[model samples]
Target: MTDKSIYRIVFHNQGNIYELYAREISQSAMYAFVEVSDIIFGERSKVVVDPSDEKLKAEFSGVKRTYVPLHAVVRIDEVEKEGRAKILPGGEQKGNVAAFPMPLKPPID
Candidate 1:
């Protein structure tokens, strides 16, 4: 892969759909998890600020790597370049695509 390679990762998290861009992505050592690192964000301008982008930046700040469950991932694609990283409303069902249902809590032993 070229150094300029960028990947767009879309996934469902806590009722939100997250769109993220990263330089590195691979299967995690942890079972059923995807490892993502080197997150990229759009350059910010003082003229305007996006709340969604800001929220995502704050949430992922200082995070070196993240593991996402396989079932939660909507899709991953290699794009020509990085794009704005933001979170979209997951509750709305615009397309036929749907997120896989997952239990909110683990069963008690």
Candidate 2:
């Protein structure tokens, strides 16, 4: 891959869809988590004021590396160019989308 290669990572977080771009993506030492580094953000002057993007920026600010649970990851794609990173609110019309259901436990005596 070239130095300018960008990777788009889409994941589900607390009922929201998070789309982000990074320079590097790799398996993390922490079990079951994917490591994302070198997050890419467009130039502040050229970018519009997007609440979703702003929220994401604040959430990831000062973070050098982030570990996302494998189960939460929706997709990962390597593209020739990077796009604006934003969050999509999970509204009532989520449609056929469903999170991986966790197994229930039996009642303890």
The TM-score that candidate 1 achieves is 0.84
Candidate lDDT scores, in order, read: 0.87, 0.84
Alpha-carbon runs more than 4 Å astray in model 1? 92-109
TM-scores of the candidates are 0.84, 0.81
lDDT of 1 by residue, 1-109 (tens): 5678999999988878899999999999999999999999878765788899899999999999999998889899999988889898766567787546732543579
TM-score of 2: 0.81
Give the alpha carbon lDDT tens digit for every residue of 1-109 in model 2.
4668799999877767799999999999999999999999866885558777788889999999999998888889999898999998754446686556322334779
Q: Which predicted model would earn the best TM-score?
A: 1
Query: Stretches of candidate 2 above 4 Å error?
Result: 93-109
